[model samples]
Target chain A: MTGAPRRTIAIVGGGASGVILAAHLMKVSGGNVRASVIERDPRIGRGIAYSTELPEHRLNVAASRMSAFTEDPSHLLSWFRNKYPEARDEPGRFLQRREYGQYLADVFAAAAASASGSGGLVHIKAECASIVQVPGGLELRLSNGTSLASQIAILATGHDPGPHPDRGFASAGASVPPIDCDRRVVILGSGLSMIDAWLTLQARGHRGEIVAVSRRGLLPLPHGEHRNPIKLDRADIPFGTELSYFVRWFSDLIDEREAAGGDWRDVIDGIRPFNQQIWRDWPISAKRRFLSHAKAWWDVHRHRIAPDVHARAHEAIADGKLRLIAGKVSDIADRGNRTADLVVRLRRSGDRIALQDVSVLDCTGIIRDPATGSNPLISSLITAGMARTDPLRIGLDVTPDCAIVNFRGEPSDRLFAIGPLTRGTFFEIDAVPEIREQCQRLAVGLVG
Target chain B: MLTKKGKYGLKALVHLSRLPAGQLAFVGDIARANNIPKKFLDAILAELRNAGFVQSRKGKEGGYRLARSPSEIKVGHIVRVLDGPLAPIPCASRTRYEPCDDCDEATCQVRHMMLEVRHAIAEVLDNRSLAEMRDTTNDDLDLPQLQQA
Candidate 1:
């Protein structure tokens, strides 16, 4: 009945992007494309990022802006109403991360159901262990020994945990699992993950001195009150390509946003959609230069806590429950009892520096080897020479359109990637807004 | 960025609604028009089918058609069918309603306020059909320009 049969697609990792990709593919194929989503965990959409059971952990972005689709920006807001029917007026409300997880699950389920009804069938296997390229498409090996051959594979595996730095801390002797413990836990990094760690610690009744120490020891700023009703204008600001120029330009832009009756936070949120374009616009040298010199400052300013979390963190600091310290870890020598003796160069009081000895916790956060994904499909593709890490070592090598670039620097015709894993190629890829766009584009590529 | 279900549900449905009865448009054609990725759109259309919104025809000259008229398919229904609840906060949601864990629902002042907001949001999302969204002018929903200081 047909000259060539339609090829099935296998999407590895059923996180937000993976599920979104599957759902989009089903729609684009008009139920003609056979597809399957392979996730290591039983829960498809609730990956490590959003799998938290805590209600206090909230989405970083506002619900109004976090629609599943850009065109239908109100979709998420709509869903929120049908479920809660209580918090609808609060546009700036932050929701429990666990509930968001449920929302994601619902989306995935709907997509799978739709696929089945269309005769296209979307199978979600909870145990795909490895993926290797076959002659026509891909050979996916599941943990249960079953395999599926498909024409296209999309790596939508989400972010891996942060890396564990080498040092005496690596030796797990007497080291209390940094999380859910009652100790004077001194976290080494002050980022969102550290905040998460802090929240978890506090929630678990860790009453000891919780010091979040870093080079600058800067705690993320709290979400400021929404001051400006005016949208930010981008046309007047000419984005410079050099790191120095970009920094200056961004600083000026912050001033501009403030002048428009908003804070730098508003400016950052306003530019969220254009971040990819801005990253792409810059030369690789500039992007790399940013990572080395400016990333820390940029991150502190960019990723902020919800106001409620920020207040809690601040109160903890004021009450001596948590201490934020700025210093350099000169050395982390091995000490007995799973603790490391840290030599720190504390910022000078009045231009005179002092050295302090403190026991430290490596709350540096989850380290995922970005060069490779934890998913079996990504691991297999890399081993098979179908994909390689980016030159910058930020993430996997992929084209702007999200195609996987092999060791030979060739974009795979049948394989693609998206979500946090593609951050190397697209700097703004970590957030949902960017990934949703990528999912849409990647789905179009599959059919086109 | 709309999730594949959010965008493609409207996309494939739009294409199918425009076509004559029994004539199905392939996923590729609809995706190109809507700028949705093919793979993601595929899953989204499948969702529409399962929700009893669309029907598919396999083999040659086969694709998908709407199960009901565009007028009958509300945008919120598709969203609920695909994305679950529209509200992000529990107190605002209608279908999966449970009071925030820390507070009592009956006496919670915040919960009562949110309920009103939820009703307003539902009025718009649940009532507006895909046919109406398709007909809406771009200018009607044009993104506000970033104002310069």
Candidate 2:
């Protein structure tokens, strides 16, 4: 190891968050610190979402909003133009995800180049397997059986695949193979992920029927045209401590927005900037109190769908290619060769039990329960008492600055986290704006 | 659906895996055998070569061979080398964790929780090698587990 007094930082998981963080640190550090990216895969950037080769896999967000660095918001748009000049006419359009992945890779390449040319090395190791926090810093185990020692480490792990369902009946499910392409698939959730799965099945030429089941069966709201906008007057909305009161206020606000000719997406998007603050400022008891009753509705309102994607989903629904069922799954019986029969309980009806044959796909969104996380590092950290799960158990609890809090209610000096995993702490962590804000703040604190 | 690149790359790799060691297979042969576009497969091969997953011998009898033994190389390695990190989010990614500059990874609750996801993904990719992917199985009962899962 090179002996130097310089601070060496090791970053794990080279996804969007990691790459952006690295880029920001290099820009902000101005060659004072050394940063190394330890990626388990041989690829340095281009995480799963952007690595698609399908041109139809457009990003959910517009190209104008996907710059790697927050300060240079137009960077991605400019890059897009240079890469695909034919799409110059549409500025706010969702570009293909493959193009976005290339853009991110190019951004990281430039950052690494700048850091290297400046004599501040930005080492991007292709394979980092495990990391252990040490006395002075952190030690990362590489796939090649080597270890890198650094003073600080950041964990930017990316998205988790959906959860696996429990054991069920053999006869109840006979139409869908566990992962068959032609099976009558029953998607467990009705969100963006479910849309992706449905689209994927269609792309694969799977002609079988698709069923999306959720408790509410509430499909995502579509992005509306920027016509007659519904502007909410927050002045009249009385602040209330009770969950029912807040729900009543929100429902009324929704009604007003729709009446004003503005789509619900507009109302939700308009409130997003202040959403986290509202969650933070609200009494913790009230916030926890809302989880049981109002949270599901809140999620549907907040995470809207792309207009084109929504239209496609609606077309599928209208054509009967897709079915939306509002019910809780009671049991699933494996039939044979990727087929299953399921028992469903309607949420509204008291005693209506429906039995049907379908394939089940768990598109329940990224696994929220950190307790069920299959990562050894996280399990070790929790067992060693370095981190504590939040009251909701969706994720770990951290202090405002994002330091992981231990069971005794103390923040760890050595440990840190970021990204969608903080859903319990921050309601709006998945979007680009919040992530950019987060990357900026975290880089500053680390450099400072 | 896996991307065209991934699908083609996997097919090409599987085809390569079945061939005798050190024997060069032509790009045309790989493309024709797999029914992948010759032009697209060429580009993918170039990437695989540059990424050190494939070694090509350019000549009349030349095609491509595994840079490493089939058992040693992982499908994840080829995908990642040709593509990028397995996970998209910083928190779920196993290898690269540059804390978003705007937030403190140490103090950020979101990042902390994502660490679990990142490790889980990293563990799967890191543990599984190409050699494992090339092992052929006729067991129809073998649920082709998306090992990445």
Tell me the alpha-carbon RMSD of every candidate.
Answer: 19.8, 28.5
Docking class of 2: incorrect
Candidate 1 chain A lDDT trough over 10 residues, lowest sum:
A167-176
- In candidate 2, what are the lDDT values of residues A1-448, reduced to their tens digit? 2343566777676777778878888887777678877666555566656655666567777766778877888898888778768865476677777777787678788888888855264646556656677778777777777888887767676565433435322211111223555567788778776776777777777788888888889887776565233332222222212344456555766677778665667656666665675565344555677776676677676666678888999999999999998888887777755447778788788445554666666666664567657555555667867777787776778776777888799986656677766667776778666877787788888774
lDDT of 1 by residue, A1-448 (tens): 2334666888888878887787778767776678888877777777766777766678887777666676677877788888788764588777777777778777777777887755364546666666677787778787777888888888777765432446434311112254435555667788887787677776677766777767778888887777243242222222223466557656876786678566777667766666776676455666788887787887877777798898888888899888887876666666555455566667654232322333455655433455443445566667878888887776788899888899899898888888877877787777677777888887777774
lDDT of 2 at A352: 51
Question: TM-score for all predictions?
Answer: 0.68, 0.67
Give lDDT: candidate 1, residue A312: 88
Chain A TM-score across all models, in listed order: 0.87, 0.87
Listed in order, the DockQ scores are 0.01, 0.01
- In terms of docking quality, model 1 is incorrect
Cα lDDT for residue A211, model 2?
A: 87
Which numbered prediction scores highest in lDDT against the true structure?
Answer: 1
